[model samples]
Target chain A: MLAGSQNRVQCTEIVLFGVNVAMSWAAVQGWFHKLASPPHFYVTAGRWVPWLGASTVVLLAVGLGWSLFIAPLDQYQGASTRIMYLHVPAAWMSIFVYLVMAGSAAVGLVWRMRLAEVIAASSAPLGAWFTFLALATGSLWGKPMWGTWWVWDARLTSELLLLFLYLGFMALQAAIPDRRAGARASALLALVGVVNIPIIHFSVVWWNTLHQPSSILRLGKPTIHPSILWPLLVMAIAFKLYYMTVVLLRARCALLERERSSAWVQQIVTEQIALCHPLR
Target chain B: MIVDPQTSPRLGRALRTVLVRDLTLALRRRGELANPLVFFVVVVTMFPLGLGPEVDLLARIAPGILWVAALLAALLSLEAMFHPDYQDGSLEQLLLTPHPLAVLVIAKVFAHWLTTGLPLLVLAPLLGVLLQLPESATGVLVISLALGTPTLSFIGAIAVALTVGLRRGGVLLSLLTLPLYVPVLIFGAGAVDSAAGGLSVVAHLSFLATLLILAISLAPWAIAAALRISLE
Candidate 1:
């Protein structure tokens, strides 16, 4: 009888997942449809920037206020438990953004879409920053919890590898002269690197080693108390919004840089920079 | 429309002729064959010096050390896979042919496997004896090389294609491809270690063969794609 209700809950989650997928698909489609033309993207981005900025501020404000004050502290960890609000979310976003970046890269490769390339290039630096944040915050969390600031734990090691993969992609792109070719090659590299992500995840499970065993705080099911869980959930949502705001901004810059030769770009740049006028 | 059963069609004939010509060119420079072999020997010898002179300890680590050396040597030769042809613009001539570049890449991969990979397998028994690998372990050493070396060739082909045009691309190729090589390293080293422990070699060999098949099926496509991008 309990199994029946549990199955019902799972079915509900799957339905929710489906709805989430459709919503995300529609939202992204609407976003790109407007941004498909370089001039349109530039003008549209100008108008949307304030809204993205405002949404980010509001979400982060609400999320942080609840997490820092309203959410109860963990009995075991005390105030140090607050670190999860920053650490867990940063770590999740770091990995999540790379997958999205790589997916955009794959689309760029398959369709040779200029917008996709802009998105891929834009995603890298931001993803790298988040990855660094994850590692930094993770180290901070580790010092208080695991008794050391750093360990060659499997999860930590894999996170480090992910960072290297990002660096490799960036370096490979910088080395090649032809932008289009570089984009394609880097996209292939990204695709290949993402394949290894799963292997990195399972490396701990597959091997008996010093890495900490899987925790309830990880994906799928939560093993932590409701007190600990609520703050983490809020922080995760905040991080997702933070990533979106930054990625869209960077994508606008990348589109401008790549499409600077277009007439629309010339008009947009002239209009935007006309007030200052040329130094000449 | 004439069909020949034994002899290849015109395109096939061109590919085979090119293959034979390259093989002959390689055979004429027998000293070139010794480069990887000597490099392999030197690399294997360096491990003992670096790790200190403990024979039993050396024996224990021998399989891993030996595979690493072989992997490095294979990588060293990959630079040469397209270097000479690329420099001479002979690769362009071949590309211009009616035959597919993929076939040419396959032929080159085979030639590399023959010249470098085959020699490594042949020399494994000697290395095994020197490292005190035991008679039972010889089969594991041989089989791992047999299965693992093709993977090395296929993967190396992709790296070679990627770096074929750049000057002094050897180190970059090694760094880029080495991480991709970890799975083969794990299984190859595991196979020999398992054999040394009196465990089932069959299971390890099966895994090795699976890796080899996967490499064979997919690596040519990757190599071709990389070549097109680099040469574009």
Candidate 2:
């Protein structure tokens, strides 16, 4: 009886793991499609903006406070190591959002889903911004540690290419006259280029290189002390919230533009104006 | 739209009709083809000027420089493939032909390869000599171009089809196709450089040939699909 119960618990755990992974990736599309229809999203944004804004503010305060003040200095990198609180999460988010952006694009293209395309388009600018942050912070960290502002290392070069991919996606969409066609074509390009990113990530490990291998993420236990790890964890959550706040704003804009001709859009616009001028 | 291939006479007539029509049109706008060729020569020459008076350094970088020039030259001409025809409604007329549009598109790609690719291949050896490349590398150079340039034409055709109707698509076309060209760039340059260093070049040439065959069989259909979207 105990064995069977344990087996059931194991199965449930696996199912929950799958759900979390899927939701992390698919939540943007699901939110936009199911609950965040033009009027619902608009009205909800009006109601929830305060909560989102407040939580984000609180999270940033706590996360940044914990990371910079409480985390112990690294043994190897010493003071220069503190840059991890900024660099690692930005880098992780850059790759994560790109995968989401490309996956959404593929879904949009194959299914002709306008909502998927809107989310995909909305992800591009955010992905580009994160990529810039990763590059800038990386350069800052590299200068003090590696003694140079730049190196043509594999990861660095590939990150630059990701920026180019984002720029190309934006340029193609803006340049194309037919918006739907532009979305489809750029989606195809994104799908094709997705393979390069993994190659970039593994290139250092695959070949003998000067660049250091994985530090925070690896198969074994993390090498860092707890004092360092806690702040890193806190900062990661803060960065994620920052991303959510920005995506919410962008998605709300996209929802309005995509559903402009719908009645809900008109009503939401009217309500927005009335809120802005309550005395009227 | 279906060709009864058992009727050899009709198949031959359809093929010839496409080739003749494309060639005649290309011949009239001879300047379109010349632009890419001139760009190729200019880019190749600019390298020697930029790198300065060291023969060894020029020879060392020759393979990469030549391949880069060829890649850019191919891209420069790609926009012309469907742009003028797309603009002037000739593509619509071609679409109306009883023969398959895929076959018609393939015919145009062939004409493009002949006018643009063949000239670059012929001119490559002269540029190779200017860079002080060894004679053995010259053979690898020509053969790689022979195999690699056709793949460029095939791949570029798809980008051209995708951007045929868009204004200011030339730069965007480069961005889309440049990454796809990296494997070809690596192998083509590897072949010439290996030969220049007196290493075996056969393996690289064979790989280039395999890629070209794969691209030739696949790209026409993809380009045709892209063309349909642009037109629609």
Candidate 3:
């Protein structure tokens, strides 16, 4: 039961969200148990793929058009600020995906959940690409506005290092021959990297201040106008949906490849359109 | 011989045996011990040849160059840290021992550092002089490295354990360890960089200590976990 709220519609959502928070322990455990079965996860994620892809496209279209053409130009930086629509979100997602990847990897390691392992391993390349996009778009914005291609600011260096971390995770995954071992080992590495990320980021921030006594490159205004903020938020959500869609697709392919010998896989291969429904 | 780990039930005794065993074995193979030292000297020397011996330039970059060279030298030795043990089946025996693997891993990492990192610490001052590092900063270079190199070995142990089972893990080992080494590199060199400028060096050195403490407390479990993954 939830506490009192104003509107009836919001009351329902609030109650629902409250219950979600309250029972999350039992619910999450049962949810993970259900999803741990590869066949179930494959079918469920397959059902959601099309809807996720469609939402991503629609959001991207609106977010992209609005940010590029309709958002207000900054008084100081002018239109160059538009790139933040992609840069900030991609950068944010880069770290977001790392956490998700590492969290799933940790769960996978602890529980030996095959689906979680697939999700964790499949998330690496997406994280890397997002990191790359963040760097590329950041540099593009930097060249025109900041008068340099790069700044050794805290965020920039951390992003570059994050890229390397992703690459290293992928490299470790590829090096080991045994599938299960490789996944678990790289999962361990991912968890290790996650713990180090904050240390690296803040140390870079501290190091930057120590060396560059007078900081020239200032980050965006702390109180951004709503006109810019709204579009940025939209773009961020769209990028998230994009990640969800691609990760599911990748997970499914990886699932099939890894589980080719299982009866469910054989049944699916024998019968086209094998995905009859989502998780019941 | 399994030697019955239960016979040496004391944690201290087990740790000492592992430490002494690694150190004595490393001592017997004295020639292999020189490889990282030689590699360190050669890497530092190559910089002057490549950069044309500009005193101010080399002096400016000395801290970075020396710190990076030390890191690479440590990594060069890391490939062999556990591979030989794994090959000889002793790693399997080590895993099977009743003693805590994390504690034993700490012992092994410490021994590796004493053999590899300490020598580099001793050699760094010579390279500093060659690189024209300011005399006052040399001590800071040594101290920063003293704090940083063990952390590298500790961190590198995890990567080595993960990759030790592979036939071609050399490239993968470096890839996996190098990014994680960046924070230590920044602070280790930053400490020297500050010292050369006659600035207060406490912050950087303190950061190095922080990193060392962090690695010591956390890395053993990771190395132990990776070892289990590789062996299984």
Candidate 4:
């Protein structure tokens, strides 16, 4: 009898666990459905933008200040190493934003979601800017260390390819006249370009090793000092927040343009017009 | 919806029809068929003139130059891959066929490779000589082009399909496809370079082969999807 009762209790626990999992999954799905709606997303993103923007400014200021002033100079690189804070974050964001864009593109393709498409489109220019920044700063850093403005180093070469990928995405987007078709086409390109990232990285690494063994110095160590690591980490966070702020702002503008004929957008436009033309 | 074997031939038959149709169309436009090959020769010849008649320097960069020219030549031919079909309403008819669109797309790509890429492959050895490529590396250059150019056609088909609906697709097609072509160029040229240096080129050849297999298996589906999106 006691054994039977124990089995019953175990069965009840399993049932409860299953119920909990299902409930949470449903809740997540509900949240996504709500977020997928344009008006809902517009309102939510607008509310979050100022907060994200303010945090970005604060974090970037603190992080850059800490990196430039408080952090000790590298024993080897001296003050020239200061560029790491910007270069590293920009490089990191370049890859991170591509992944995000690709993810949103996949979602947009699979679910036919407009917001995901907008997010993907909006993320490309930002990704390109970050990639360009990384390349520029790396060149600046390379001048002193490698004695040349540019070398076909593995990382830089792959980063250049990444910039091309971004340009291709943007160019595809601009060429198509149909807005939705353009989004879908560029989304497909993004998905295809994602595969090139790893290939570029590996090929560059292999090419670098074969040609120049000791020419380009790697940026950071596996065991970085805490003082330097913390500032770099903080700067990375700041860049991410900045991406969020900018992407959201761009997506909101895109949404306004795309949804101009919808009722909610008309209402918002009327309110703005009323505010602007008080005499009328 | 039952398919009668007598009334409707099998999917294989449908695919063959697509292949034949594309080949026939390509053959009718001899100028279009020969354009990429002509471009390939022109680009290869220009390199010797532009870089001076320094045989040694030309020979050193031969593999890279040939591979890049082949890539650009293939790119030039890709714009016409589906433009006519898309314009003539045949693409919509193909989409509506009972057979799988991917198989039909693959057939079209195969026809494209036969017309454009095969000519480039045949012409590469001649260009190799012009660049003063070592005699021994000529075989590897031919092999690499044969293996790599099909993948280029397959991959370029996706980009061409994506842009086929647009009026100004030429520049966009290059922008979209060039970066993707880098891997093929790397492996293809690397193979010949290794051969020129008397190093083992088995690894590079294997990479090219692997890329070809992957592209052949996957790119048709992507092309089909892109076509659908564009048509819509």
Taken in order, the candidates have interface RMSDs of: 2.4, 3.4, 0.7, 0.9
Chain A (alone) TM-scores for all candidate structures:
0.80, 0.77, 0.86, 0.95
- Estimate the overall C-alpha local distance difference test score of candidate 1: 0.77
Candidate 2 per-residue C-alpha lDDT over A14-111 given as tens digits, one digit per residue, 9 for 90 to 100? 99999998887698777757652456655666667667777778877887777777776765666677677888888888888899889988888887
lDDT digits (tens) for residues A1-280 of candidate 3: 3434447768788999988887997888888788789898989999999999999999999999999999988777888888989999999999999999999999889988888889999999999999999999999989987789998767889899999999999998987778889899999999999899999898888878877766465445778788988999999999999999999999999999999999999999867644554342
**Residue A265 miss distance in model 1 (angstroms):** 2.7
DockQ, candidate 1, comes to 0.30
Residue range with the least summed lDDT across 10 consecutive positions in model 4 chain A: A214-223
lDDT string, candidate 1, A1-280, tens digits? 9999999999999999999999999999987777676667767777877787787788788778877888877666666667778877887877888899899899988878877777788888888888888898888877877678886666676677677778867766766777888788778777867765674455433321412454323322347667667767867876787777787788888887887898887887787687677653
TM-score for candidate 3, please give it.
0.92
Top model by DockQ, which number?
A: 3
Give the true-contact fraction for every prediction, in order: 0.12, 0.24, 0.90, 0.68
Model 1 Cα lDDT, one tens digit per residue, B1-232 = 3446555457667767777877887888899978999999888878777888777887788888888888988888887778888889888776666556777788878877888899999998888877777678888898899999889888878767776777657766765676667667767877888788778877668767987887787778778777877787
Encode model 4's per-residue lDDT on B93-151: one tens digit a residue: 99988788898898999998999999987899988998899999999999999999999
Per-candidate DockQ values are 0.30, 0.30, 0.81, 0.77
Q: Tens digits of per-residue lDDT for model 4 on A124-223?
A: 9999999999999999999998899999988899999999999999999999888888889999988888876787677668767766798767755668
| lDDT winner between candidates 1 and 4 | 4
Indicate whether candidate 2 or candidate 4 has the larger DockQ: 4
